[model samples]
Target chain A: MEIVIVSLLNGLVYGMLLFMLASGLTLIFSMMGVLNFAHASVWMLGAYFAYEVSRFIGFLPALIIAPLLCAAVGAAIEVWGLRRVHHNGHVAELLFTFGLVFIIQRSVQMIWGMLPMPYRVPAALDFPLFTIYGANFPAYRGFMLFISALMLLAIWLMLKKTRIGLIIQGALTHPNMVSSLGHNVPLVFTTVFAGGCGLAGLAGVIGGNYLVTESSMADAMGPIVFVVVVFGGLGSLGGCFIASILMGMIQTFAVVIDASIGDVLKPIGIALSSETLLGEILTVPMARIGPLLPYLLMVFILLFRPRGLMGTRDT
Target chain B: MSTTLRAGAMPAPRSSLVGPIFRIFLIFALCMALPWLFYNYTTGRHSGFMLTMFSQMGMMAIFALSYNMLMGQAGLLSFGHAVFFGLGGYFCIHLLTAAGGGSLPVPLEILPLIAGLCSMLVAIVFGYMATRQRATAFAMITMGIGELVATAAVMFHAFFGGEGGVSSDRMIDRSLFGLTYSQGVQVYYLIVAWSFISILAMLYLTTTPLGRMANACRDNYERAQFMGYDPKFVRFIQFALSGLFAGIAGGLSAITYEIVTFDSVSGALSANALLMVFIGGTNAFGGPILGAVLITLMQSGVSLISNSWLVYVGVLFIGMVTFAPAGLAGLIAMHSPLQQAGRLKPLIVPYIRIVVPGLVTLIGFVGVVELLSFKTIGAAQGKKLVLFGNPIDATTAQPWLIVTGMFLLGGLWLWREGRWFHTLWEAMMADLKPKKGAAQ
Candidate 1:
């Protein structure tokens, strides 16, 4: 019971982190049909920037500045790089960003060096917030929950009440109609792209300190972000949120459980040896399978529903 | 759409003369003579690098060409092509290890075929599911399938060997003519022969009804449907055949490296295939060959010189996408008429001026990148800082100034030369006369 509750809390934090990344990716993907491969890289940059800023100025200010920096870079990439490639085709745009991933990753290594940075939880939120059944909940996690909830509320209010948000929703569903309405579709694209990147940067700011701030964090988190976006469906924040939480839960729960096929088959007298392949597979702990869960879900979702969980179109 | 531009015209005598058979022979002759040419002229005693590079290029050439079949001919861009390639490689390694353990009698030369067939079998299963939709849906499904297989590759130890991967010896006891195949050059020759055969086979496939149908489907699926063909079925077969070719390449990789790992099916490799195929030019059958060779050469060579090679590649890929979407082949092909009309001589000076500045810019770019990367990654690791074979401090004003100066000067020179180059090219294209009634 204790384990389950702890896992739930951990999963929620993870899910919120995923949501922060995926929401931006989803918005950009929805508004502009180019899947930004460098979105995760930007997130990584945010983390590294936050680490640096936090070292000099403190954590709260670092969080604000890092995401702003990310937004500026994102807007520049949109105006200078992607806009030029857009005329060619979607594949070209995708490839252009694909190239950006390598550049950003290498650039991060160049700036931050190979080793993980010494990013720590802020002193104010360093202690335990509470304990449930002897499993202590860290204040940093509470902070994360607060931030994510705040972001969710802000995104919701903006989308429902703001002109840019309404325009984005319209563009998401009817791109042609939006263009025909004489709105500068390109300007909207740049704004959404920059905003999405800002969100990713914000996610990175929290995630980097929560997990170790490292050069490889982008690469490690990249596939999971893709999984979340794809599983949730492009252009659907609601779906993105749901998929993020589900993936988060699946990953967290998978690690704590130790059951395998052999465990299930124990009563049926299926004795196994380490030398045999099947036996080896059945003997491996579920904890090690944690890395495989998100990918597995992605494959399952893609094979069964290419458009994603709640995708309106076949993206 | 421009009346001033002489495109959609008769392709000219140069295209006719360079015909399929002639090109094929030329490629084969070059493949054969390359090793000896390098052994004689270039750096001596490092023939190992040459053969290794040669084999790697041949394998990647097949991979890229197969990718072009789908993206270029069939117009379906797949993001997860490494699935088939990796699958083929895994199976090939399994077969090689199995043979090493004495369960088969087939020679090493025939092993790639078995790998191809296995890849085809897997492709058939996956392609059926993937081909149900087109465009974005197809891409997503393939991505999903790729992730699934990659995950499985790390999970299943029997075939995939988990994370450690599978390894085997090429020197199995069985031989057709008692060739042990121990030497790298021998392996190179084997790769060349297989590459030639596979390329020719792929080219031949393109000329067939199935290939034509695939193109037709790509151009306009609605029109293809009206013509009594199922577009999905055409795509399925094309996907499967492409898988067969890609698998052959993977088989060669397995045989050459004597090992297979999850990296074989990694997203990086998949992206590499896309880059090679697209950069080479997807408009022509031979485009991927050019792309594969150029890209592989850059990857292996440039990586040694600069850590920011990925940045260079990113810049090049973006440039190609924006300015030359038709690719390097298309750019080359656009010049055929000028040569045929004997009007190429006037453009030589402009070409050289452009090329020289471009090379300078590239060199400067490489230098700056190397300097920065070396300062960051290399300096931290305590690696030597050698410039012109002498140690030079990176923090010194001289090196920094030199790199900075080169970047600024080279970039300015290249920009100035680019205007002249474009003017010359546009003038040449405008001067050509288009023949009446040719397909656009």
Candidate 2:
């Protein structure tokens, strides 16, 4: 029971972190119809930037500055790289970003070396915030949840209550209509692209410390984020949110489960040996197969529901 | 008019057939002569490195061409195409092991064919699920499938052999050619023959009805549907055929390397296939062949010199995606119309002007990358930065400034020269257009 509670809390924290990245990716994907393969790379850059800034100035300012730096980089990439390839088509744009992943990763390794940075939680948030059954939930996780909730509220308010948000919403569905109405659609695109990157950067700033700040971090996190976006369905942030938490729960809980298919089937008088492939598969513990569960879920979901759980548009 | 039309139609098939046949023969001859060309008579043997590299190029050519069947011909961008390749290699290695143990009586020559058929079966199963969606969805599903298989490969040790991977002896002692399979040259010849056949088969596929319909569906699925063709079925068949060829390449690799690892089916290899196809030019039939050869050369050659070879490849890929979407083949194709017009001589001066700055800029960029990498990776490895036979200190500021200045200045000059060249090209093309119209 205590393990379940701790896992739930841990899962929530991880889910919120995933949502922070997924929200940006979904927004950019919905607006441009080009999935930024380098979105995770940008997140990695943000963590590095924040580590650099916090090394000198401090963490609070780094939080604000790191995301801004990521936004600037995103803007530059849009104006120079993506915009030029835009004429060629979406596949070209995707390939361009995909190529950027290699460059960004190599560049990061060049600058930071091939080791994990020691980016730790602030001293103020280092202590336990509360006790979940017997497990002590850290204050840093609370901080993460607090910031994520604030971001969620801010994004909702911006999208619902602001003129720029209205323009963005209009452009999402009707770009030509928005363009002819005298709103600078290209500038809006740059803004959204930068804004999405900024969100990713913010996620990096918080999650980097919670996780490990390393060069391969992007590679590790990239596919899972894609899984969340696809599982939630395209063009639906609400779905993305639900999918993120569900994935977080699945990953978090899968690690704790020690039972195998053999254990479940043993009650029905089915004895299995590990010699055969099917037997080996059935006998393997769920914890050992934890890393593979998300991809399996994604494939099953894709095969069954191509539009995802709550997709508003065709994938 | 009727006689002239019939004459034109009659010559079309023969004339078209003759060129490809000639090209195929030429390619076969070149491939056959390559080992001899690199032969070290002093040692009384072929250069092992050269033989291995050439053999790798042939296998990769088949792999890249197979990938192009999906990307270029069928317009399906698969991120998990390596699954079939890897699986095929795994099966081939296992079969080779069986043959060695006398459990299977099959000769090594026909192993690749059996591997290809196995891959085709897997493709039919996977393709049925994958071909249901088009465009981005297809790409995503393929990616998911790729990740799943790669993860399972590591977990399911029975088939994949875990981290150490599966290995087998190539000398199964069952060759129809009556030659012992112990020599590297013999294996090289086997690869060359298989590559030649595979290339010809893939080329022939392009001229078939299904291939044309695949292109039709790629360009406009609705239009193909209106023409009473199921785009799904076309994609499925094309996907399966592509898998067959990829499997053949995988089998060749298994035989050559005598091992099959999870890396063969990993995302990196899949990305490598994409890089090869895109770099070679997807629009041309022979683009993948060019790409496979060039990339294999770079992998074997450039990687030896630079720690940051991937950076160069990434930059080159991005540059192609942005500026040269038609790729090396497309760039070469651009010059043909001018050559035919008898007006190619005038552009030589402008071309030289562009090339000079381009080379300078490339040198500058490479210098910057090398210096930075040397400062980090090379410094850790305790390697000195050597340029033009001079060991220079990467810690110093002087080399940095010079390279940066060169990059900026050369870039400016290249941009100006590029504009001039573009105007000149446009003028020449415009001039040729009118003359061609008049002639017609």
Candidate 3:
């Protein structure tokens, strides 16, 4: 029971982190019709920036300033890089970003070296925030939760209240109508691109410390974020949120359940050995197959629901 | 729309046999002769570098052409193409090892065929799932499937041999001739022969009824359906055939390297396929061939000189995507319009003007990149800044001033020269208009 509670909590936190990354990707993909292959690289940049800034000042200021810097970089990429390739097509745009991934990854290695940085949680948030079922939840996790919630509220409020946000909302559904109505669609694209990159940077700021500030962290986290966006469906933040939590729960819970399908089958009057492929597949423990869950979910979703669970657009 | 974009203009419908037949013989002679020329002249005994590079070119030639069958001819952008290539290699290695163990009595000459068949089977299963969707969804699904196989290759110890991978002996006793396949040159010949065969087969495929239908489906699936054809089926078959050729390439790789790893089937190689196809120019049948050769050359040559090879490739790819989607072949073919009108002489001065400034700009840009890389990366690694065989300090202001000055002046000059080049090109195009109209 304690394990279940702890896993749920961990899952929620991880899901929120996944949400932070996936939200930006989904927003950019839906509005622009181009999947930014360098989105995770931008997330990685956030972590590196925060680490650098934190060394000079503190984590607090780093968190605030790192995303702004990311925004600036994103603006340049959109205005100078993506705008030039805009005439070609979406495939060209995707390829351009794909190229950016290699450049960013190599550049990151060149700048930071191949070693992981020593970015850590602040001393103030290092202790336990509370005890839940004999488990101590760290204050840093509480802080992460607070920040994500604040971001969620902020995004929701902005979309509901602001003129630009309303325009973005309109573009999300009826891009042609929005364009025909005399709104500067290109400007919107640049703004959205920058804003999305800023969100990714924000994710990197916290996620880097929570995980590890390493060059390899981007590659590791990139696919999972993609899986989340695909599973949640594009053009639906609510769906993205739900998918993120579900995936997080599935991953965390899968790691704990060590019993194999053989054990489960033994109780149901079926005796199966690990001699055959099916039996072997069934015999593998849940813990061993934990990493495969997200991919399995993605394939299943793609085969059944091409548009995803709540997606208004097809991938 | 998809099918028509590729098949609307099929070059010329008359006298195809005479023209292609002559070209094929010429290509065949060139393919057979280049190796001997290189063997006698360049890097012949230079620590097996040239031999290895030649063999890589052969395998990549086959690989890139197969990739073009999808992107260029069929308009299917796959991100997991290396799956077949890698699997074919693994299967070949396993067969070779088994042959060495005396259990399998198969001859070494037919090893690639067996591998190709196996890969084709695998492609049939995977392609069924991948070809169901089109465009972005298709690319993403292939990515997912690719990651799945890559993960499994590491996890399952049954056939994959885990992280260590599997190795095989290549000097098999089973050969068509009485010669022992021990020397690197012998393997090179084998690769050359197979590459030629695969190229011929793929080219023949492009001229077939299925190939035409595949082009139709690529350009306009609706029109294909109206003509009583299934787009999905055409894609599936084409995908399977592509896998067959890719399998042959992988088999050659296995023969050359004598080992197969998960890296063979990784996303990086798949990206290489995309890069080779896109950068070589997908509009031409020989685009990926050019891309494969140039990329292989760059892989061998540029990588030896600089560590920032990926940055160069990335920049090139993005530049190609933005400015020249048709790739190197398109840039070359851009002159065809001028050639047909007999007005090529007028553009000579304009070309020279651009080339001079272009060279200057390249030198300046390359200098800045090398200097920055040296300061940040080389310094930490205790490597000296070496350019033109001379050691220099990167922190010096004189070098920085020269670099900036050259870059700024060259850039400005190039811009002005570019305007002139454009004006000349536009005038040339205008001059050719009357001729084109008269011919039509």
TM-score: which candidate is best? Answer: 2
**Pairs of colliding residues, candidate 3:** B1-B219, B2-B218, B2-B219, B2-B220, B3-B218, B3-B219, B3-B220, B4-B219, B4-B220
Candidate 1 residue A181 C-alpha distance from true site, Å: 1.7
Once fitted onto the true fold, the runs of candidate 2 whose alpha carbons sit more than 4 angstroms away are B1-15
Ranking by lDDT: 2, 3, 1
Better of 1 and 2 by DockQ: 2
Rank list by TM-score: 2, 3, 1
In the range B316-337, model 1's lDDT, one tens digit per residue, is 8777887888889998998888
Error of 3 at A149 (Å): 1.5
Looking at model 2 chain A, report the run of 10 residues with the lowest lDDT sum: A168-177
What ranges in model 1 sit over 4 Å off? Answer: A265-284, B1-18, B40-46, B387-391, B433-440
Model 1 CA lDDT for position A295: 72
In the range B1-440, model 3's lDDT, one tens digit per residue, is 44542464355343565676678678777766665665555544523787788889889999999998988898888888899899999999999998878898987878988999999999999888878877777777778877787776776556776688888898879887755778777788788889888988887788876688888988898898887677887888899999999999999899899999999988889999998888999987778888998888888888887777777788788889887988999998998987877878877888899999988887777677677777767787888877657776788788777777788899999999888788878887887888888998
Give the winner by DockQ.
Answer: 2
Every candidate's TM-score, chain A alone: 0.97, 0.97, 0.97
TM-score, candidate number 2: 0.97
Predicted candidate 2 versus true structure: per-residue lDDT over A83-199, tens digit per residue: 999999999999999999999999998878787999989887899988866688999999999999999999989988999999988876677899999999889889999999999
lDDT of 3 at B112: 89
